[model samples]
Target: MTITDAPPGTRPARRRTIGTVLLWLLLLPGLCWTVIRLGGWEGHSPLVPLLAFTPYVAVGAWVPALIGLLTRRRLPGVVALLTAVALAACVLPRALPDLDKGLSRGVALHVMTSNMLFGGADAATIVTLVRENDVAVLAVQEFSPGAERSLAEAGLGDLLPYSQLSPEWGATGSGLYSRYPLTGTGTRINQGGFHQAYGVIQPDGAAPVLVESAHPLAPAGLDLLAGWAGDMAAEPRADPAGTARILLGDFNSTLDLAPLRTLIASGYRDAADTVGRGLVGTWGPYDGDPIPPVTIDHVLADTRIGVQDVTVHNVPRSDHRAVIAGLILPMAS
Candidate 1:
C-alpha cells in the first residue's frame, strides 16, 4: 500500500467515534434536567421539590460544558452547544416574562412580603425595606413572638398603623401589617394545618382588595410535600372578576410545582413573572452558597391587578430575601 493508503477500518472507526461522542453529549445532566423540566414532573417525593430549580441547574451546567466544547471545538462540542440551545428554547418561555398583557387600569399599592427566619430577622432591616419601598402593606411568615416584640420595639406600630398577627411557636406564625385599615380580619388555616392571615384592605377612593399572607408548609419530606400541595389546592379558586386578590409570602414553593402552576392557570399571575424579572432567587444563600438559588417566596396577584414592578431585597439575619411588588388594583367606582 502507498504511504497515504487508508487503513482497513478507518472510516467505520471514525464514524463510530463521532457517533459515540455525540451520544455522550446528548446524555449530559443538562439535557436530562431540561427534559425533566419540560416534562413537568412534580410529585410528593423530595426530589420533586428539588426539581423546582432544575432550570437553574440546567443553565448552570453550560459553563463547564461550553468551556470544554470551546476548547475542543469538534463535532461533540458543536452538538453540546446545540443541546444547550435546544434546552433554552424549550424552557425559556416559562422563565421569560410575558409582557404582551398590558397593565390593568386602577389604584396602585406597594406591598412587601418576607419570611422572618424563625424570628431571627432584624427589625430595622425589615422596617427599612418597608420605608424605602413606601410599602402600603407588609406580610410575613415565621413571625414568632420575639419577632413581634422586636417589631413593636423598632416602631413598626407607628410605621404601619393597622395589623393582623398570628404568631405560632415555629414556622407556622404569620402576620400582616397595613397602612390602611384591615377589615374582615380572619385567620385561614391551610390544608397543611398552618394558619394563614388574610383580610380586606380599603384604599381611599378605591374598592377594597382581598389580601392573604400565604405560607404553605415547607416540603422537606413526603408528608410536607403533600401538605404543601394540598395547601395550594385548598386556596379558593381565584375570583377573576376583578375584585382584586393578592397572596404574598413564603409559599415554600416555586412556579414549577404543579399546584403553583395550577394556581396561575386558574386565574392569578406572579408579579415577578408579569414584570419580566425572570427567576430571581428569593430563597437561599444557604450552606455557604454565594447567592440565592431558588425563588420560593412570591407575590401573586389576580389577572386584573396591574404589576408595575417587582423586586427582591436582602433581609439581614434571615435566609430568605423579601419580595416587593408595585401593583395597581381595579378600583370600584
Candidate 2:
C-alpha cells in the first residue's frame, strides 16, 4: 500500500506532461503557420495557400485533443473539443459555398487562371505547374505578347492541343488552352470594354463545357468597379444544357466587396468558398509590405459541376498567385 499509494501523484503529473506534448504537437505547428501566414511581408506572402484551406488545419488540431477528452484526459481534451467546434462553426458557414449535388458527376476537369504579371518569370512557373497538375483547361489573365510565347514554348501549346488568345487587352486579358477539342470560339463575356475570350471546350468523352475566361476591369477609378462587377454577374446564362460552366479570371474584387455579391447571388458559387478555404489573399506576393490578403482571383461554378478541390499555387514570379480548381460532374451516368 505504501509504494502503490504514493505512486498516484506521479501518475497525474506524467499524464499532464503527455497532454502538454500532444497539444504542442497537434496545435502549435498549425497555429504558428497561421501566424506566419497572417504576418505577410511583401512577396513573402503565404496568404494564398493559407486562405485556400487553413480552417481545416484548425479543425485537424482538435482531433488529438478530442481523443484525449474522450479517453478522460481532462483539460487537453476539453481544449481540443472546444477549439474544433468553434472553428467549424466559424468557418463552415462562410467558407462552404452552397452548391448543388449535381456537381459531383460526369466530366472531370481542372482549370486555372492567373494574372502572370506580364514580364515576370512566374509565367513559366505557372505554365509548368498547370501542366504538372494536368489541368484540362488553362485560362490566363494578363497574357502579354512575350509571356504568351514563353508559355507556348513551355509546352502549354503542345500539351493543351487547342488554344485561343485575345488581342484587345494585349498583355492583360484572358486566353484559353485545352487538351480537348475547343469550339464555339468567339467573344462571349465583355466587362468594362475589356474583351475576354470564351468558348466551348469538349474534353475527351465529356460534354462541351462553356468556358468564360475573363479579366474584368480593375477597380481603380471612382466607384467604377461596382458597375463593372454588376455587369459581369448579370451576363445572361446562354448555354443550352447548362452542362457545366466555369467563370474563371482575375475579377479584381474581393469576395467581401459588394460587387461580387451579385455573382454569388446569381447561382455562382466560388470554388474556394465551396471547399471552405477561407480568406485566401491572392494578390500580394511581390509588393514588399504587410497587407491582409484578399481573394481577387476566382473560379466560380454553376451548380451543374462538382468541385473536387480548390487550391492556390505558389508561383513566385508574379504579383498574383494562381487559383486552380478540379471539377467533376456528380450526376454523370
Candidate 3:
C-alpha cells in the first residue's frame, strides 16, 4: 500500500494540485515565523508577537505537527518532526513558567513571590518559610485577613520592617514587604476590575527601585488577554521608573503568552532565563501527580539587574509554591 507499490495509474492532477497548495500553506507561515523570531536578535518590537497574537502562536504548533502527520516523504517528515520538536522545546517551557530556576549567589538584591491562599489551609507553614529565608522582599497574593495577622505574628513586619498591604474586592490582594526603606506608593493599576499596587523600594544608600506587585485580571475571554497587555503597557509610561522595575506575582498567563512578550518588549528580562535555572514548577501538587506540575508564580526584572539564582520553595500549606530570586544590581563604576 505504499506510494511506490501503487497500481499502474498516474495520480490525479487535481490531487497533485491540492497537495501542493496544502504543502505551501502549511510550510510558508511557519518558516516565515521562524525567520522573524530569529531576526529579532533578542531586541524589542513595539508589539510582541506572542502577546498580540496568542491564538496564532498556540495553534501555530500544528504547522509542524501536521507536516509530521501528512508527509510520507522521508526527508520532509523527518525535517518537520525535528522542527516541531525544537520549537516545542523553545515554546513549551513557557507553559511551566515556574520551572525556570532563576539566579543565585551574585545577588545584591532578592525578592520572593508567593500566594498565601489568603489564610487557606496552611498559613503557618507559609509564614515560616518566609521568615526562615530572611526574604529581603516579599510579594504575596491572595492574602486573607487572618493570614495577614498570622504573617505579622510570624515576624514579617519586624523582618521586612517596611511594607504595604491592600485588601481589594477579590479573593486576591497584593502586598509588598521590604527590608529597605519605602520611599512611596502609587495609585492602584486597575484593568477590567482587577487591581494592582505600584510602589518604590529603596535600600539604604542605594538608588530606588520601582516595584509593581500585580495579579492582572486573568483573561477569561479573548479580549481580556489583550486588555491585560494594554494594562501592562501603562506601567512603564505611568511609572517612568518602571524600567527599573521588578515584577513579582502569579500572572496566571504563561510565559509563552503575548502579555509576557509585551512586558519583555518594555525592557524586562525574565530572571529565570537570565540565571539558566531548571524548570521550577510553583503550583500544583495536583492530586499528588508530579509529572506535570503547574507554575504560575514569576519573578521578572530589568536587564540591568543581573540574576544570580532562583529557587522554588515548597510551602505545604498553600496550593502554590513560592518563587524566590536573587538579583545583582549594576555596580557603580
Q: Top model by lDDT, which number?
A: 1
Q: What local lDDT score does residue 39 receive in model 1, on the 0 to 100 scale?
A: 66
For model 3, the superposed segments whose C-alpha errors exceed 4 Å read: 1-72, 75-79, 92-107, 118-121, 221-227, 235-243, 284-292, 331-333
Q: Per-residue CA lDDT of candidate 1, range 80-188, in tens?
A: 6765776666446655668654456778899999899888788998988888899999999998999999988888888798999998877888899999999999888
- Superposed Cα deviation of residue 183, candidate 1 (Å): 1.6
Q: Which of candidates 1 and 3 reaches a greater TM-score? A: 1
The TM-score, computed over Cα atoms with residue i paired to residue i, of candidate 3 is 0.69
The TM-scores of all predictions, comma-separated, are 0.85, 0.66, 0.69
TM-score of 1: 0.85
Please report the candidate that would top TM-score against the real structure. Answer: 1
Off by over 4 Å in 1: 1-22, 25-28, 60-86, 89-97, 101-104, 286-292
RMSD of each: 4.3, 10.3, 6.7
Q: Which ten residues in a row are the worst by lDDT in model 3?
A: 40-49
* Tens-digit lDDT track of model 2 for 149-211: 778777777778787777433445557888877788776455466657778876666666678
Error of 2 at 305 (Å): 0.5
Error of 1 at 75 (Å): 11
In order, what lDDT does every prediction score?
0.78, 0.65, 0.61
Q: What's the residue-level lDDT of 240 in candidate 3?
A: 39
